[model samples]
Each structure stands twice: as structure tokens, then as C-alpha cells.
Target: MAETRTFDVVVLGGGSGGYATALRAAQLGLTVALVEEGKLGGTCLHRGCIPTKALLHAAEVADAARESETFGVRATFDGIDMAALAAYKDGVVAGLYKGLQGLVSARGITLVEGHGKLVSPDTVEVGGERYTGRNVVLATGSYSRTLPGIEIGGRVITSEQALELDYVPRSALVLGGGVIGVEFASVWRSFGADVQVVEALDHLVPAEDLAVSKALERAFRKRGIGFTLGDRFASVAETDSGVRMTLESGKTLDAEVLLVAVGRGPRTAGLGFEEQGVRLDRGFVVVDERLHTGVGNVYATGDIVPGLQLAHRGFAQGIYVAEQIAGLEPAPIDESGIPRVTYSDPEVASVGLTEQAARERFGDDAVETLDYNLAGNGRSKILATQGFVKLVRRKDGPVVGVHLVGARVGELVGEAQLIVNWEAHPEDVAALVHAHPTQNEALGEAHLALAGKPLHAHN
Candidate 1:
């Protein structure tokens, strides 16, 4: 029999949410046990966010070199060095993982290196050892999902395999045109691969605002990225050379590799969650607004929860849960206020309700929208990026949504989130100053137009 342990909080799966909960709970002077089957920083640090973003950055650098003549630096456009790129991406992940390990150690949190399962609401069993705590947080994170009858191996792959590929394919077919799909497609295209995306939806990044999606589609088309929208994937077969895919509409396509980027599903199965009396909806842990499972002090956060599967969202929920356990009574998280970004070239970033959603909820008469073209912004012109900042607000009321599509637009989501979360009126945002000759100025310009004081744009 293994020895038993006790802590104030026992967090299962040391992914973003699990480690974050342990760190914050320990900061509040609570004894914490963070269990993991793998590395501490979890998928985000090792596989998902960090490594993927590093790839995107590399793609950006490739694009810069390929288009350097536009900037008049007289640089030669060379192909990507896969070995060096892998090394660079791995270096970034390794540095962050090391720092996270150091932080966990310094915080005096017990790092249990094993797969943990909830034997009871308050007890987690790992390696035949029981760790009991007053509170337990489930944050097992997520895994890449595949379609029915479509196995991921060899020529057919998911984002995980795509990230670690030794060589870019001559041509690739990406299934699903959502965030992950479009991002991978963008990276491959910039790396000089002939990339074609097939989305079941009508547009790329369909979850984003319609205008933003349309803009992204146009940009992708201009970049020579081929896509077949509104087409459902029927089947895929591995060929001697690559993959051959057939759509539900009886269309056939072939590529050197087929990337199945149909998004991710929460990793919760056979881990004793249901046996422990925690409720689950379609494999997602059911939690209240406070993230509590309503099953004996057990809570769920991150991808395990049914909301946004963003790493940052997971981090925020972990902190909230820790504070709640410490009697801080933190306010519940607002799902819509969370920022969303797709890190493809000509990235899309948004916060709050999308224009269509806002109108659907508040009625068309209650909603008004303004689109400020980035073409009018000096910085955008300099970057040679074409897109817009769109603002959606209640007629004569607060700004309800902010959507942006352009190069480096993801960085502007912080302010957009602040505006929507605070329910700031268009006039309120317009009253503030945005520095000239910056992509950020496009946001301010949109607000100014919405506030009925257009600058650098037509009213």
C-alpha cells in the first residue's frame, strides 16, 4: 500500500489550469499538490500555445523574407531550415517550461509526477497513493480530435503531428477552417506550401464576426491559399504518395498531407470523474459560474470546462478557483468578455459579442456597427496590411463588441477586452488618445467613427 498525503488543495493534471491553481493556492498560504502525467507547464507550454506560436512567428519571418523587396532591404528569400526552426521553437518551449518548474518549486507546492484520478470528491489517487484535500481542481486539458472513421496517423495528422513535422509538405489539405485549421494552413502557406483548407462552415474562422471572417477569406484568397467552404469532410484514405480525401458533396481532393484540425475535445474519460459524482456534458466537466462541480468541493477549469478552450482562460479560471477556495469570493467569470484570437497571418482578434450575435441578442435596431479600414491608418499602410477594426455597440449605448483583422492585431485584444468587459461606450473610448502611426490607432479610429467623430475615415 502506498502512503497517503494531505493538502489544502489537490489539483489533477498539471496543465495550465492545474499548475495555475496550485501556484495561486500556495500563494494564498494553502498547501497544494499538483499532479501531472507529463511536464508541469502542460499542453500550452509544451505542445499547444507556446510551440504553435513559435511556429507562427517563424512563418512570419519567412513571409518577411519572401516579401522583403517590398520593404526595399534587398534580402534573398530562402527556404525554411526545418532543423534550425525546430531547434528555435523547442528552445522557446524549454525556456518557459524551465521557468514554470522553478516557480512551482519556489512556491513550495508538491509536484506529484503521475497520472491522477479522483477516487472521491476530495481524494485523488495516483500510483496507488491517495492525496486528500479540502478542494480538488480538474484541469486535464484537451487533445486533438478526429472525425468519425478518420484515424490520425501516417499521412493523416492532427495539429500535434503537424507542429513536429521534419519537412513542410509540397501541398497540404487542412480539414476544418476554424482557429487551429486556419492557423496551420496560414503557417504552411507562408512556408511556401500549397495549402488548401476545407471548412464545413461558410467562412474561415466562422466563430468570428461575419465581416472579420469575410476579410480573412479575402486575404487568404489573395495569398493564394485555396479553400472549399461549406463542404463537409466525408472520408480520407492514405495513398502511397500522400492522402486522398472525398467531401460529402462527392468532391475529391489530394495533397501531400491531410491535417485534421477539427478543434479539440476535453480530455476526461475513465479518470473516475463520473464515478466520483461529478457531472459531465459531452465529456466536459459541468461547473457552475464559479467553476465548482457542485460535488463535494471539486471544481473544473480549462479545456475540461465547457467554455472557451483558451490557455489564458484556463489560467484565469485557475486563479479564480484558488481565490474562491481561499474565501476571497472572486466574481464569476464572464465568458463573452474573454478575448479570442486566431494567430494566423492577418490574425483575427475579438472580444465581447460578435456583430451578428449582438444584433440577435439586442435586436437589429438596438445594435449599430462601424468598420474603420486599416488602409486609413498610417502604420497599416506602412505594413502593407489591409483589414479593418469593427465596433459593435447598442444604439446610443456602450460598445458591446470589438473585432479586428490585420497583421499583429492580436496584440490589440487586451484593450478590446477591457472596453467590452467594462461596457465602455464608444464616446468613452473615443475620448481617450491613441498614438498616431500604430495599428492600435485603427481601433481608436473605429471608436471615433462609432462615436460620430470620424478621423482618418469617412463618417
Candidate 2:
């Protein structure tokens, strides 16, 4: 016997996308039911984004303390206290979780706690109870993926296990040179681990602008973090202490631990989505521009929807879907219009097209760029970080792309995104004065150079 319940909207999963959809739907005067089998904030809050950032920040604090003498500060650099750091990170998560719970409760969104399986296009079944809604949302999110013939146990672990480490390994071999791989590699290197990154691609963070990849490699090298570029990972075997990896170049590397920083796959297995006529490509839910599925009133968002796989992107998509279901007819989101940031050492942030991408899209003759060095930025110089701001634009038109690399550069991406989204011309950005002696001035300086003003730059 199954209990029956009904709502105006039913959201599957309680992650970033799911929660956002539920919240927005409830706010729109829809009775929403949010179902979850785990903690609410999902991977970003519990494991992925929040905890990793806390670790990165801890690493930052350690680096700052270790290099305090350069800043004329008399401070002794001590090793990390893993227990305290974990507590601080967990505390931040807990407080935020409490706030989120309060928010959902106040909005009158029904919080159904269980694993939900879509029994029909309009119904989700959990614990032998049926929850029905006029509209259904699938936001099951994703899980860290492992490669074929790769076993994740003991010393070989994914990002989930890496986030909960009680002690940093003495040496680490990280597979994949993308965002997750580079981020963990950066954190480990900062924590005094002998790290070697293996990327099958040509460079680390390969999806970013090539200049950014080169800059990151340079920075990591200067920090003594070793990596193999333009090589393929052939095989890996568990050793007595850790693991041994062989590359296609016939090079063998050993480390105390091997981190599989490959990537994530949508967690859509056995959820009954396909059984309900919802289309799926591989494991990802198929959705159109409006986030609607093949089944009537069924929609999908977040990592399961086969786009950016970013939490913020999930939030945006979720809100958009909610509004769409409410008949608000919200404007569709352009996938490429989203901002992306890699929170590694000498962080990489970008919005709009890459340099090569811009050239391809608008043609090489139409695309022009200016690279503004951080050496010209007083704040960056004071911070003793090295990198640059590279802006791409049409030869005589608006800025098309902005790429940034250096310490704390991720914080400046908001303005860069606005410039790209609004299609502001170099002259338009150049006319505006950024506050002096700030890293943000790097963006302004790049625009100045692009506009042929060439302040603080060699043209």
C-alpha cells in the first residue's frame, strides 16, 4: 500500500538545482514538494565546492604565513592542524545548511526525505508513497566518475574522499588536468605535498584559454609542483605504499597516493526517468532550451541536463525552469554566456569565448586581443602574484571574452562577465575608471590597451 500526496510542483533531488527550483516554485505561489535521500545543499555544500574551497583557503593561509617575511610580517609558519581545519570547514557548512533548512520551511515547501524514483511523468515515488505534481523536475545532480579498469579503493580515491582526508599525503599523483585535477593538485602542493599531475591533454586546465594554461604551468613549476604535459595516461597499479602510474611515453611515476581527478557523470541511473518517456542521451537527461523534457510537464536541470555542470549554472537553470513552468516565459539562457572559474593556485576565470574560439566564431581578422600583465597592477604586485588579464574583442566592436589568471582573480570575474554579457566595447570599458592600485584595474588596463590608449603596457 502506497500513500498518495499531491503538489503543484515536484522537484527530485535536494541539491543546488533541485533546491533552487523548489524555492522559486514555492515563491511563485506553487505548492512544491522537494525530495532528497541525502543532505540538502548536495555536493557543492557538503563536499564539492564549499569544503574544497575551505581547504584551498586553509592552504592560502598556510602559504601566506610561510611567506609572511616577504610582506614584512614577523610570523612563524607552522604545519597544518587537520582537525581544526576540518572543524572550521564543517562549521561553515552546518551554519549554511541550517539557514537553507529555515528558508525551505518558511517558504512552505514540503521537504520529503527519501530516495525518489519517478513512477510517472507527473509522480515521484518514495518510501512506498506517491507524490504527484502537475509539473516534475529532475535535478539528481552528478557523481565523480572513474575510468574503465580503474578501481577506486585504498590509496586511489575520488574527490569525495579527498575532501575528507585527515592528513595530506607526502606525495601524490593526480590523473586528469582539468578543473578538479588541477585544483586538488594546487591544494596538495600548497600543503607541502610532492605532487605530479598527469594530463592526457596538451596542458593543464586545457579547456581554459591556452595562455591561462601556460601561465598556470609556469606558476605551478615555480612552486615546484611537477606535471607531465602532452602525455597520455596508460595504466596505473596499486603499490605497497600507494600507486605506480605508467604514461604512454614509457615514463613511470610513483606516489604515496593517486587521486583520480577525472570528472563527474550525471547521477541518473535507475531513477525511472526513461521509463516515464523522459529522453536521455547516455546517462544525461535530454532537455531543450527551455529545460523541458520529452514527457509533458517534465523538465530537468543541473548536471543531469548535459551542460555546464556548475552549481551556479544549476541554480540559474533551476530558477529558469521554475519560472517557465509558472508561465512566466523567462528568457532562455545561453550556455556559453555562463561564467566559469577554476579555483586553483593562480586561479583561472573566464567568460564568453576563448581566444581561439573567438577567432573561429568571428574570424581571425575580426578578433583582436590585449594581454595586460599583472606586473602593472599595484595590488597584484603588492600581493606578489604573477599573471595577466587577456581580453578578446572584435577589431572594432564590443569585448567578446575576458580571461584572468593570478591570485584572487576569481573575485573579479563578476565584472568581466557583465562586460561580456552586455557586449561592452573596449572604448566603453576604457572610459570607466577602475579604482587605482587594485587587481580589477588589470581589466581596465587591458581595455585601455585594446582601445590603443596603451596605459601601463607596451604596444
Candidate 3:
């Protein structure tokens, strides 16, 4: 026996994207149903962003204790307690999950707890019951990806297993030097593990500005983290003690754990997406500027849609889709304006074009750049952090990009995003007063240097 219920919007996948879509649609006075096979808040809350950051914070605490003498604080460097650390991370996630549940419930959005499959463009079936909507949103999210012929089990693991480890390995070999790989490497190194990273690209965090990537590499090397760049992975074998990885260069590296952090693939197969006329390009939903799937009243958001794959990006897309469904005609998202932050030892944050990208788009001669060293910032000196704020702009026009690397630099991205998104000129930003001895002042100083004032920097 199957029952049919209809709503104004039926969102599949109760992750950041789907839940956000449901929340905003409900707020706009549209009836909504949110389906999930797992808990609400999805990977970002449970497996990806939230839990990983907790681990990183614990790692920071460990590093602080180990380096307390540098700050004139007498403290003993102790080992990590796996049980306590897990409990703390789990506690943080539990609190957020509870809060999200309450918010969804309060919004009067129907929360369907089951595996949902799109039986048609406007209808999803869960446990033989069909939930139909005037419009449907696909936000199935993504799963951890691994190289071909490489198995993830026993000593070989993914980020999910890495998060649930009961003991810290003496050594770890992380494949992929992107955000996930570098982050786990940072955490393990802080927890007293020797880490080696493998990247098929020339630089770590290769998608970032070349300057930021090079700075991060220097920082990692200074911290004793070894890496093999420009080499691809060939095969991995389970050893008696741990695992052994052989690179394409025929170099063999043995470690207590092999973390396959290549990337994530969209979770869009066997879910009736194509059957419902939704076009998928290499497992990602193909959508227009407004997120329409070119299908009947169907829209897709989040990792499945294949742009940034960030949880925050998913949130924004979900809100946009909801507004569009409500006929609010919200403006399309400027993908370049979205902020990106990598939460590692020396955090990397950026918005808008990179120097290379700006040069390619606006020409090298048309762009001017400035690097404001954190060495000159009062707050950076206080924290003993090393990095810089790199700004790229039109020769005499507006700031086109903002890239930052150093401790707690990710926190400064909100203002950086605003500066780039609003197309603020270096002169305009330079005129603003920033609080003295704050990290944000670094941004001001960078803008000042770019505006030809050269405060705290050589011209």
C-alpha cells in the first residue's frame, strides 16, 4: 500500500543544500518536504567540515602546548587522548544536529526519514510512499573517491575512517594534496605523527593562487611535513604492520596508515535522475545559471551540481533555487564571488580571481598586485605567524582578488569576500580605519600598500 502526499517543494537529500532549500521555501509560505537517508546537516555536519574542524582545533591545542615556551607560557606537552578527543568532536556535532532538527521542525517542513528515489520529475518515492511536489530539488551530495584498483579497508582508509580512528598512527601517507589531504596531514603532525603527502600536481593546494600555494608549501616544509609532488599514485598494498604505497615513479613509501584523500564524487547514480530527464555530466547534475535541470519543474543544487562542492556554496544555491520556485526572481549567484577557505595549520583563504587568472582575463599589464607581509602586522607578530595578504587588482580600477595565508586567516575571508564582491577599489579600502593590532588590519595595510601609500611595507 502506497500513500501519496503533495507539497510546493520536495527536496531530496537532507544535507546542507536540501535543508536550506526547504527552510527558505517554507519561509516563503510554500509547503515543503525534506527527505534524508541519513541525519540532517549531512556530510558537512557529520563527516566532512564540522567534525574535521573539531579535530583541527584539538590539533591546534596540542601545538599550542608543545610550543608554549615560544609564547613564554610554561606548559607540558602531553599526548592526545583518543577517547576524549572523539567524545569532544562527537559532542560538538551532536549539539549542532539537535539545533538543526529543531529549526527544521519549527519551519513546518515535512521531514521524511527514508531513502528517496525520484520516480518522476515531481514525485519521489520512499518506502513505497510517494511524496510529490510542484517542484523537486536534487541535492544528493557526494562520497569519498579513491583511485582505480585501490581498496579502502583495514590499514587503508578514507577521511571518514580517519575521523573515527581509535589511535594515532606513528606515520601516515596521505594521497592528494588538496584541502582534505593537507588538513589531515596538519592534524596528524600536530598529534605527533610523521606525515608524507602525495600530489599529482606541481604544488600543494594547486587550485589556489600560485603565491599562496608556494607559501603553504614553505610552511609545511618548515613544519617537517614531507611531500612528493608531480607524482601520481600507482598501487597500494596492505603490509603486515600497515600499508605500503608505490608511486608512479616506482618509489615505495610505507606507513602505518594510507589515507586516500583524492577527492569526492557526486552521489547521483541509481537514483532515477536521468530516468526523470535530468542531465548528468560525469555524475554531476547539469544546471543552468538559475539552477534549472532543463527538466520539468526540476532543479538541482549542491555537490551534485558540480561547481565549488563547498557546503556554503550548496547553502547559497539552495536558497536561490527556493526563491526562484517562489517566483521571487532572486539574482543568479556569481560563482567567482564565493569565498574559499582551507582550515589547516596555515589556513588559506581566497575570493575572486587569482593573479594568474586575472592576468589571463584582464591581461598582465592591466593588473597590479601587492603582497603585504604579515611580518609587518602587529597582531601577526604577537601570534608569531608567518604569511601574507596578497591583493590583485586592475591597474587603477578595483580589487579583483584577495588571497590570505597564515594562522586564523580564514576568519578574515568574510571581509575579503565583501571587498572583492563589491569591486572595492584599493583606495576605497585604504581609506577605512581598521582596529589596531588586529589581524584584519593586515587587510587594511595590504590595501594601503596597493593604493601607493606603502604603509608598513616597502614600495
The most accurate candidate by lDDT is: 3
Question: Please, what are the lDDT tens digits per residue for candidate 1 over residues 93-126?
Answer: 9899899999999999999998888999899999
**Tens digits of lDDT, candidate 2, 415-434:** 99999999999989989999
Candidate 2 Cα outliers beyond 4 Å, as residue runs: none
Q: What is the Å distance of residue 119 in model 3 from its true position?
A: 0.6
Q: What is the lDDT of candidate 3?
A: 0.95
**Residue pairs in clash, model 3:** none
Question: Which ranges of candidate 1 are over 4 A from the true structure?
Answer: none
**Is 2 or 3 the stronger prediction by lDDT?**
3
lDDT of each residue in 68-131, candidate 3, tens digit only: 9998999987799999999999999999999999999999999999999999999999999999
lDDT of each: 0.92, 0.91, 0.95
Better of 1 and 3 by lDDT: 3
TM-score of each: 0.99, 0.98, 0.99
Off by over 4 Å in 3: none
